[model samples]
Target chain A: MDSSKVKVVTCIAPVNIAVIKYWGKSDENLIIPINDSLSGTLSMDFMCAKTTIIASPELQENTFWLNGKEQSFNNKRLTNCLQEVKRLASKSLPHLNWKFSIKSENNFPTAAGLASSAAGYACLVSALAKLYEIEDNVSFIARMGSGSACRSMYGGWVLWCKGSSPDGRDSIAKQIAPASHWPEMRVLILVVNDERKKYSSTDAMKRSVETSELLKYRANQIVPKMTKACIEAIQKKDFEIFAEITMKESNSIHAICQDTYPPCVYLNDTSHTVANAVHAYNEFKSSNKVAYTYDAGPNAVLYLLDSSVDEFMSVINYLFPPQDTAEYYKGLPLSSNQLSQDLKMALNIPVQEPGCLKYIIHTKIGEGPKILTDPQQHLL
Target chain B: MDSSKVKVVTCIAPVNIAVIKYWGKSDENLIIPINDSLSGTLSMDFMCAKTTIIASPELQENTFWLNGKEQSFNNKRLTNCLQEVKRLASKSLPHLNWKFSIKSENNFPTAAGLASSAAGYACLVSALAKLYEIEDNVSFIARMGSGSACRSMYGGWVLWCKGSSPDGRDSIAKQIAPASHWPEMRVLILVVNDERKKYSSTDAMKRSVETSELLKYRANQIVPKMTKACIEAIQKKDFEIFAEITMKESNSIHAICQDTYPPCVYLNDTSHTVANAVHAYNEFKSSNKVAYTYDAGPNAVLYLLDSSVDEFMSVINYLFPPQDTAEYYKGLPLSSNQLSQDLKMALNIPVQEPGCLKYIIHTKIGEGPKILTDPQQHLL
Candidate 1:
C-alpha cells in the first residue's frame, strides 16, 4: 500500500452474525478459517457503521478515529486489513498521492458483542472500492478488512467461502440468498452490558489452536456439518434446521471457549438468565422455533420466528416488566433487596426499575447495505 | 475395613496391554472403561511374580511387600485398592479366620507401562479366589482389585464394561472372544526406553477429562462408533477397521495428552522413529496390513495378521535379533539397537555398537487359562 497519496472515500455498512459460527482459524496471519462458516448480515436500519478515508501530506502515519475520538490503529491485525485494502486500491489508482486518514464509528455499543467491526470494515472497504473503482470489486476489497466483512457487501443471507486459495482473493463473500428470501426470520437483540475485551479474538483463537484438539476436531467435523445445514436451511427456508444448527453451533463455540486454558470469561449472569429462559421456553414447548447465539460480550442475539414474537415478548415482559408491576411479579424479577430477603426467589435478570435492559428492539431481517445521503445522522 | 488386621493380603499383578485399545472411562472410580480393550496375557514363562499370603495370631500390623522388599502402602490410592479387594474377599468368606502375611515380587519391571499392575492384580485376585474358593467369582474379585484387572483374569481378548450401573457391580471384565478365537492376530511389541513418565495415566486421564474437550468428542463421538466397528471386525475377522481404529484412537489419546496444560509427554524420538517407519511402510504400501498401538510406556505393540509375520518381522526384525535379545532389551527397548551394525550406523537412535534388542518372540495368538495340576506341583 502506498503510505502517501489519498483522496476522500466514504462507506456505510451493516453488522453480521455467524449462523454456523467460526470458532477456530487455520492460518492466523492469512485469516483462513478451518472450515466454511455461514453468517447473517443485519439490517441497515438497526445496526450499521460508517467510515471515511482521506489522503493528505500532514499524516506522518495512519490515524484512526471512532465516533470522532482518535483511536489506535497500530494493532497489526487491524493494520493488516487496512494495508491490504490500501494495497489493492493503490495498485490501480497508481498516481494517487496523499497521506491517509480513517474515521469510523459503530451506531451501537462499541465494545458490545454485536459485530460492529464487521460493519465498520465493510463500510471502509466499500468506500475505498467506490473511490478507487478498482477491478477487484467491493468483495475483493472487503476481504482485506475482515473475512466476515466481505459478506456485508451483499444483502441478506451471505456465505463466506472457507476458501483454499492461498492469496484469499477467491475467499471473498457472496450472497447465498437475498435478505428478502427469509425476511420473516427475526432476531431479538438481547443487550447485556460488559466491559472491554480481556483477550482479542486473534489471541484467543491462537491459544485455542495451539492448546485445543477439540478445536481441531471442530474445524474438521462439526463446523463443516453445521455450515451445510445452515446453508440448506436458508435455501429451503427451513427454520427448524436453521434454529437447531444455530443453537447447537453457538453452544459448541461457547463450549470451546470454556475448554480453553484459564477459559474465556465472555458471558455473564444476565446473559445466562436470558439464555436459560429461552431454553426453558423452547424445551417446554418441545419445538425448535427459537435459537440464541452470543459473541465476545454477554449480550445475546435470539433468532425467533415471526409467529413466536408474542410468546417470546411475554417471557421477556414477565422477566422485565414495568416498575409498577412489582406487586404482581413477586416471585420473579426480584430486586437486590428482595433477593437478599428471599433466597428462594428466582432471578429474572437486569433487575430493571424501567427501561432497564439498555434497550430492546423488535426487528425483522433485512438487507446488508443502505445509502444515507444525509451524512450527519443519529449515530454514535 | 479393619486397619489393624495383620492378615493383610498383598498382590503385585502385571498390567495387560490392549491389542484393541480402550480410551474413555464411563465410570471414574469403578474403572468402568467405555469399550472392551483387548490384549494378550504374556506368559509367566518369560516374566512372572510370586506372592504369598500368611495369616496368623502372631502378626502385629498390616504391611505391604513390593518385589520381596517391605514397602509403605500408606499412599491413599494404593491403600484404597488393597483395602477394597481385601474387604470383598473377607465379606465373601467370613469363616476363614487367618491373619495373612503378604509377600509379592515381579520377575519383570512393574508399572513401567507393560501393564504389570493389571496382570499382577488379576493374578492376585485369581490366587485369592482360589484360596477362599470365593463363590462371588474371580471376575468380581478382580474388579475389586483394579478396573483393568478384571479384564486381566482371562486375557485372550477382554472387554472391560463401561458399566452403566451406578454401584458398578456390573462393570466386571468379560471375555469377548478369547485369544483362541483369533489365533491369526500377531503382536510384535516395540518397547521404548524413557525411564520416567511425564505423567501417570491416572493424572493424564484426569487432565484429559478436565481440560480436554477433545476427549469428550472422542468419548462421545469417536469411541462409540469405533467400538461397534471393533466388535464387528473381531466377529467377522476384519483386520482393516480393527487396525485403523486402534491406531487412530491411540493417536487421539496421545493428542489429548499433548494438549494438556504443561503437556503430557509420551513418545520419545525412538518411539517416533519406529512410528514413522511403520507409518511410512503403511503409506507406501497399496494395502496396510499392520497397525501399532502404545501404552503409557514407549512400548509399541504391533498388531498384524499371521500371514504377514515374515514381512512384519523383516521390517522390524532389525529391532530384535537372533541372539540373547532379552539382555540387550533394557527396561525400555528401542528397535534401532537390534539392527545390524551397518543399519545401526545409518540410523540415529539408542543404537549401541552391538546387539541390543530382546530376542523377538514369534508367536501366534493362543488360549487364556489352563489348569495343570501335576501331583508333584499340587503337593508343593
Candidate 2:
C-alpha cells in the first residue's frame, strides 16, 4: 500500500419502514432491541442516503459532513461505528491506519421526519466495510450506530431478530425475501405539514422503556405473533393479511408512545386523517388496498399493491388536495386517474383544505446498498 | 293515585369524567364491563342533565323528549331502563301500569362532546327511581342505559365495580369519597373547537371490545393497579400520584382506541396541545400541578388543586388564547393572572393561534343526583 495513495468508496442505502416496530432496548450500549421487528426496504431511487468515504494517510483525522454541514466527531455512535470498522479491518488490512473523510446526504427532505438516520448510518457502514474489504455481515456494527439502521442493511423484506445473547451478535437483520419476490408491492409516503418541535426518538424510546407498562406487554405478548404473521403474509403474497398486520403494528407502537409517561405524541391530525382515509378507501373497495404506518413523526408511509396505486393516488388527491397540484408528488410517475362519485360518496370523509400533505412520494420494494463504480457518483 | 292526576318527579345529575376509563364490555347485553373504572363528578351548577318524569293513567303511551325534540321510545337502552324501573315499582305500587312522559335537557351545548349521555341517563334513572320510590341503588339500571352512566350516578369520586356475576347485579357505582373529602380539588374543562364528525363512543367501544387486543391486556392487567393507586392517591390527598395515574389512564384508554381495528380517533391537534401544555406547566413547576383527561372527543378535562388553578389558568390562557376573551370562561370566577416571561420561556411551546378552544368551564367536585321538590323545575 502506497502511503501517498487514497482509497474511496461511495454507496447509497435504502430507507426501511418497519411493519413490526422496534422500540426500547435490552442493551442500550450495544443498541440491542427488546423485540424482533420487520421492515420493507424502500427503493433507493426515490428516497435514500448517499454516503462517500475517502481514506488517506496524509489526512489529519477522521472528519464527517452531513448534507452540507460539518458535524462533531465526538458523537459516541459515530465514533463506535468508525472504531468497530477499523477493528474488523485491522485483522487483515494494512491500510486500516489511514484517516478518513466522510460525506453523507439524503436525496429527500431530511426535516420531513423520514428515517434519514437509518439510511444514513446504513450507507456509512456499508461504504466503510467496502473500503476495508470486509465481506462478513456488518449490520451489527450498523446497529451500534442506530438500532433501526441494522434493518436497512438488507433489501426487500428484512427482519431484525431480538436475540437473547447479551453481546448482541445474533441481533443482525436478515432478508426474508428479495425485491423480485414481491415486485408488485408499492409504497406511498405522505409528508404532513407540521411545525412543532419533534420529540427525539432516542429520548422518547428511553422514557418509554422506563415508564410505559403497555410497551412491555406489546413486546412480550404482541410482537412475536405479529412478526410471524407478517413473515407468512409476505411469503404467501397475501396483501390483505400483510396490510392488516402492518397497520396494527404501527398503531400498537404509537399506542405505546402515548402510554409513555408525559406521552410522546407523533401522529398529528394529518396523520390521523391519512389513516382514516385509508380505512375509508379500503371499506369503499371492500378490501385492504392500503395500509399506513407512522414513525416518531406525523408523516405516513402507506403500503399497497401495484394494481391499487392509481386508484389510491386518486383517493389521496381527493382527500388531501394539494395547494399547488404541480410538484405535489415526487418519485415514480403516476398516471392521471379520476375518482368515481360512488366511491367518493362511499368514503364520506370531508375533503381536507388544500395542502394537508406537503407532498407524496411514490416508490416500491428495492435492493439494499449499492456501490457506485462510476467516480462521477462519488461525493468527495 | 287518581286516574287523571299526574305524578311528577324532577332531578338533575352531574357529569363524570373517568380517570380510569371503561372501554370494553364483558357481557354486552347486560352492560357488564370487563374492568372497574373510577371518575370525578363535576359540579351540576356548571353542567348537568335535568330530567322530569310524569306518570298518569290518562296517558296513552310512553313518550320521551330530549332538549325539546321528541325521540322514539324504541331505543333498546331506554326501553330496558324504563322496564327495569317499572318492574321494581310493580312490587310496591299499583299505579305501575300508567304510561309515562319523560323530558330531558342539558344546560351546556349538546354537541360540544361533553359526556351528555352519561349525565342524561343518570338523570333519567334517578328521576324514575325517585318517582317509583325505589330507594335501592339504581346505578345498575343507569349502567343499562349507558355503561358509563353508572359512574355519573355517584358524587365526588366514584368507582364502578366490574362485578363477577354475569347478571351484572353486583356491578354498581360506589362513592369512594364524598365531595368534602378533598375540598381543594378543582377541574377545568376546556372545550375544543373541532369540525370533524365525532365517532360515537358506543360504536367505538363495541369495536374495541371485539378487535383491540391491547384493550384486553389493559383491562386485565393495567387498570386494577391504576385503580388501586388512584384510590390511594385520592385518599391520601396525594395530588402528584393521582394526577400521574389520571393522565396515564387517559392515555391508556386512548391508546386502546387507536389499537382498535379501523381505529377511533378522538383527540385532535388542539387536544394534543392542551396535553403538552399541561405537561409543560407541571415540568415548569417541577411537580405534578395539573393533569388532563380526554373522553371520546376533543375536549380536555384538567384536574388540579385549587392553589394551582390560577397559575394553570394563566398558562391555559397563554397557550390557547380565546378569540373573544369575554365569554371564554364560564361557571366559577377566576382571578385575573398574567403569564410571566420566565414561565413562558420555560414552557417553550408555541402559543397557539386564537380560538383553539371554544371556552373553559371552571368547576369543582360536587354531590350526586338530587330530587327537586319545586314543580317549577320540572320540564313537563
Candidate 3:
C-alpha cells in the first residue's frame, strides 16, 4: 500500500422495507433468516446511509465511526463482513496490506426500526468492496453483517431467498426489477416516533425463535406462500395483490414479534391509525390506491402510484392535520387537491395531535449503492 | 306474572386476567372460543362490575343500563344469554312472564380490555339466574354472551374449556379454586390507557380466525399445551411457571391480533415499559417475583406475591413518578418505603409521562358473583 496515496471509497445505500419480513435466524452467527423475505429499496437520494472507507498503510488498526461518533469495531457482524470482503480482495490484491477506517451515517435515526442497519451494513460492504477492487456481488458479504442488508444491496424490488445449505452463500438477495421498471411507484414514509425501539430486533428475534411456536409455523408455512405471492404480484404489476400482501406480511411479522416470549409491540396507536386510514381509503375507493407496512418500530412505510400520491396525501393531511408549527410535515408537499367527502367519511379519520406523527419523508424507488466520485462528499 | 311482586337481584363480578388468552371464535353468534383459556379473577373489593337486575311485569321491554347511560338491550348476545336463562326457568315458572331491567357499571372503564365484558356478562347471567331460581351452573349461559365471560363466572383460578360439542352445551367455565387457595398472590393492574381500545376483541378475534394462520395453529396446537401448563402452574402455586406462561400467553394473543388482517396493535409504549420493568425485576431477583399480562387494551395486570407488593410498588413509583397533577396516580397508594438501589438499577425503568399510565389498581383473587344483600346499592 502506498503511504501517501490512501485508497478511499464512499458509497450511499438506500433503506429497504420488507413486504414479507425477514424474522428469526437459522444460524445467528451467519445471519441466515429462517424465511425468505421481499423488499423494495427506497430512493437513495432521500433516505439512505452513507459510508466511507479509507485504507492506508500509515493506519495502525481498524477503527469505526457511526453518525460522527467513534464506535467499537468489536461488533462481530461488522468484523465478519470486513473479513469476508478482505478475503475476496486477497485473491486479486495479494500485496494489499492496509489498516481500514470506516465512517457511516444514516439520514434517518438508527434503531427506529427504519432498517438503518440494513443501509449501514450494505453501504459499508459496498464501499469496502469498491476500495478492495472486489467485483463480485456484495449481497452475500452484506448478509454476514445483517440479514436484511443483503436485500438492501439491490434496488427496486428484491427478494432474499432462504437457501438450504450447510452455509449461507446461497442466501443472497436477487433484484426483481430496476427503478426504471417501476417509474410510477412512490413511497411515503410516515415517521410516527423516531425514538429508539424499546426492544432490539436482535433480542426479539432470538426470543421468538426460542419461545414462539407461532414463529415456527409462520416461518414454515406463511412466509413461503407470502414470498411466492409477492413475487408474482410484483411481476404482474397487480397493485391490489401487492398491497394486500404487503399489509398482511407486515402484520404477520409484528404478530410473531408479539408471539415472542415477552412480546414485542412496535406499532403504536399512531401506526394503527395510519394502517386504518390506508385500509379505509382503499375500501372507500373500492380499489387499492395505497398500501401501508410497518417494521419493528412505529413508523409506517406506504407504497402507492405517482397518480394517487396527491389524493392520498390529502387524505393523510385531513386525517392527521399538520400542527401550527412549520415542521409538521417534512417530506414532499401535499397536492392542492382536497380529499373527497366519501373517502373522508369512510376513513372516519380522527384528528390526531401533531406530535403523534413526527414528520414524513417523500421518495420513490431508486437504484442501489452508487460511488460518490466527488471527494467533497466523503465522510472522512 | 306477579306485577306487584317484582323480583330484584344485584350481584358483583370481579375482573379476570387470562393467563391463557381466548382469541378466536369458532362461532361468533354462539360466543364459543376456538381454544380453551384460563384466568385469575381480581378481587371484587378492588375491581369489579356491579350489576342490578329487576324482573317486573310492569316493564314493557328488556332494558340495559351501563355506567350511567342506557345502553341497548337489542344486542344479540345479551338476548341469547337471557333466553338461555329463561328456558331453564320455564321448567318451574312455566306461566311466569316478566320483562327485566339491568343496570351494570364497571369499577374501571369498559372496553379498555379490562375484561369489562367478562365481568358485565357474568354478572348479568348470575343475576338473572338467581331471579329465575335456576340452580344449574350459569357459566355456560354467560359463555353465550362473551367467551371470556364464562371465565368470569368463577373466582381465583378458572378455565374456560372449549368443548367439542357443536351446540356449545359442553363449553363452560370451571373454577379450579377459590381466592383462599392462593392467599399470598396479589394483582396490581397498571392501567396504561383507560380510553377504549381502538380494535375491539370481538372484531379482532373475527379477523384473526378468518385471516391468521398463526391463530389457527395456536388454537389447534399451542393453546392446549399452554392451558395444561397454566392449570398445573396454578395448582402447584409455582409463581415462576405461572408468570412465564402468563407473559407468553398474553404475547401469543396479541401476536395473533397482529397477525389478523390489517392488524390490531393494543399494547402501547407504556405497556411495553411496564412489561420491561417486570421482566427486569424478575431477572434481578433471580426468581419470578412478578408476572405481567395485557389484555386487548394497553393495561397490564401483574401477578405477584403479597410480600412483593410493597417492594414492587416502590419500584413502580420510582420508575413512573406521578406528575404534580392530583389525578396522575389514582388507585392504591404506595408504601412509604423507597425502592432498593439494586432493584431500581436492575429495572432501569424509564421516566414516563404522568398520563402514559392512567393509574394502578391493587387487588387479588375474589369469589364469583355474589348477590347484594343491601337494596341501597341498586341504581334503580
Candidate 4:
C-alpha cells in the first residue's frame, strides 16, 4: 500500500424508476428480491448521486459522509457491500490495504421516494470498482447495499433477475437496452410532496413480506407476466403496452402495500389527482399518452414519449397550478400555452391553488455510471 | 281501482357496513354476487334512510323523490324491484291498481360512501311488503335494487349468501344475531369527506368485474375464507378476530379496486389518516380496540366496543380538531376532556385544522327495517 500517495476515484450514477416494482425480499441479509423487476435509468444530468472515494493508508478508519454530514459505516448492509467489492480488488494492487473515506450527495431530496439510495449505492460501487480495477459485475456488490441499486449498474432499460439459486450469485441486474436505443423516451418527475416518507422503504418492505399475502401472490403470480410484457413492449417500442403495464404494476405494488398488516399508505390526494389526470388524458385521446408510477412516497414519476411531452406537461400545469411559480417547474423547458379546455373538462380536476406540486423535473433515459475525468468535480 | 282513497306506508332502514365486502357480480342483470358478503346494520337512530310510500289512484304515474327532490323511476334496477315485489302482492290487493309515490331521505349525506342506497332500497322494500301483504322473503326483491340492500333487510349481523342456484331465489340475506345479542358493539361514522365518489359503487363494481383478474381471484379464493372467519367471529363475539378480518377485508376490497384497469380510488388522505389513527390506537393498547372499514368513499365507518369509545373519541378529537366547531362531531355523545399526551404522541398525526372531518356519528348495531308507527311521521 502507498501511504505516501492517495488513490481517489470519483463517479456519478443516475436514478432508476421501477416499472415492475420490487417489493418483498426472499432473503433479507443478501437483499434478494421476491420477484424479478424492471426499471428505466433516468438521465444523470437531470437526476443523480455523485460520490468520491479516497483510499488512504494514513486514514484512521473507514468513514462515510452524505451531503457533508459524517455517517456511520458500521451498518451490516454497507459492510457487506464493502467486503464484496474489496474481495474483487485486483491481485496486482495487493498492497491496497488502505482505509476508505467516502463522500456522497444527491441532486434530489433524500428518502423522498426518489430512489436516492439506489443512485448513491450505485455511484459508490462504480467508484470502488474503478479504484480497485475490478469490472466483472459490480451489480452484485451494489445489490448488497440496496436491492434496487443493482438496477442502477446499467443505463436505459434494466431488469433485476430474481434468481432461483440458493447462494444468490445468479441474482444480477442486466441492461435490456442502452440509453441511446430509447432516445424518444422521456420522464417528468412530479414532486407532489418533498417530505420524507413516514415509513422507510426498508421497514415497509419488511412489514409487507411478513404480513401481506397479497404481496406473496403478486410476487409469485403477477410480476412474472408483467416483467415479460414490459420487456417485450420495450423491445417492440410499443409505448401503449409499456404505459398500460407500467401503471398496472405500480398499482399492484401499492395494492400489496395497503394489504400489509397495519397497511402502508403512500399515495396522497395530490398523488391521486396526478394519476386521475393521466388516465383521463389517455381516455380523452382514446390512446395511452403517458403513465404514472409512485414509489414509497407521494411523488409521481411519469413516463411518456418525447412527442407527447408538451401537451402532457400543459395538462399537469393546468391541473396542479403551482403556488411558487419560480419553483413550479424544474424539468425540460415547457413553453407557455393554453391548456385545452376540453382536456380540463375531461380530467375534471379542480384547479388547485398554485403549489400542489412542489416542482417538476424534465429528463430522459440516461447512461450507467461514469468516471469524472475533470479532477475539479471531485467532492473530496 | 279507487281514485279518492290515499294509502301510505312509512318505514325506516339502517345502513349496513360490510365486513366481508361484495365487489363483483356473477350476473349483472340478476344482481347475483360473485362472493358472499357479511355486514353489521348501524343503528337507525344513528344512521338510516326513512322512506314513506303512498299508493293512491290519484297519481299520474310512478314517481320517486330523494331528499325532497323528485327523482326519475325509469331506472331498470328500481323497475325490477317494483315488478318483483308487485308480483308477490296478495290477491286481496288485486284491486290495488293505484299509482305509487315514494319519498326517501337519509340522516347522512347521500352518495358520500355511506351505503345510502342500501338503506334507501331496504326501506322501500319493507314499506311495499307491508302495504301489499307479501309474507315471502322480501330480501330477494331488495337484492334486485342493490345486492347490498338485501343485507339491510336483516337486523344485527347479516350475511348475503352468494347461492349456487341458477335462479337467484336461494341468494338471500339472513341474520346471524339480533342487535340485542351483542349490545356492546359500537360504530363511529367519521365523515372525512362529504364529496360524492367519482365513480359509484355500481359502476366501479361493473368495471372491476369486466377488467380485474385480481377481483376474480379474490372472489373465488380469498373471500370464502374471510366470509367463514367473519361469521365465526360474529357468532363468538370475538372483537379481535372480527376487527382483524374487517380491516383486512376492507384493504382487500380497496386492493382489487386499485387492480382494476383505470383504477377506482375511493380512500383519500383524510380517510387514510383516520385508518392510521385506528391502528395506532390499537397498537398503543397492545390489542385491537378499533377496526375501520371504508366502502366506496372517503368516509370511514369504525367498529369498536362500547368500553373503548371514550378513549378512542378523545384520540379522534385530538387528531382531527374540528374546522367548524358546529359540524365537528355527530356520533355518540363524546364528553369534553383532555386527550392523553402519550396517546397523541404515539399517533403522530398533525393536528388538522377544524373541519378535517365534517362530523362524527355515534351509533351501534341496529335492527332491520320497521314501521315508523306514528301517523304524523308519514310523509304522504
Model 4: residue B32 alpha-carbon error in angstroms: 1.2
Residue B372 of candidate 2: its Cα lDDT? 92
Give the Å error, residue B336, model 3: 4.3
List the candidates' TM-scores in order: 0.51, 0.97, 0.89, 0.95
lDDT of 4 by residue, A278-304 (tens): 998999999999999999888899999
User: Each candidate: how many clashes?
Assistant: 25, 0, 0, 17
Residue A73 lDDT in candidate 4:
74
True-contact fraction in model 4 equals: 0.60
lDDT of 1 at B230: 74
True contacts kept of 1: 0.09
lDDT by residue for model 4 (B1-380), tens: 45348777899998999989999888888799999999999888878889998887777888899999998877988999888888888666843677888989998877556888899999989999988888887898899888899999989999999998866888899998889988999998888753533687888999999877778778888899989988999999999999999999999889888888888999887888888889989999999999999898888989999999999989888888876766666766777667898998888777765667877888899899998879899876
TM-score of 3: 0.89
For model 1, the superposed segments whose C-alpha errors exceed 4 Å read A1-9, A54-63, A72-79, A90-95, A135-137, A193-197, A320-358, A374-380, B1-32, B35-217, B220-380
**Candidate 4: regions farther than 4 A off:** A1-4, A90-92, A194-197, B1-7, B56-60, B90-93, B96-98, B194-197
State in Å the error of residue A159, model 3: 1.1
RMSD of candidate 4 to the truth, in angstroms, is 2.2
Model 2 chain B: weakest 10-residue lDDT segment is B89-98
Candidate 3 chain A lowest-lDDT run of ten: A324-333
lDDT of 3 by residue, B1-380 (tens): 56456877899987788888888888888877899988888778767888998877777987888898988867899889978988888565732587778888988766545778888899989988888888898898999988888988888899898888887988999998778988998888877654533766788888888888888898899889888988888888998998998888888887887777767777776777888888788889898899988888888889999889998888777777765435544455546468877777777666666666666777778888888979798767
Give lDDT: candidate 1, residue A67. 82
Error of 2 at B28 (Å): 1.5
Q: State the weakest 10-residue window (summed lDDT) of model 2 chain A.
A: A86-95
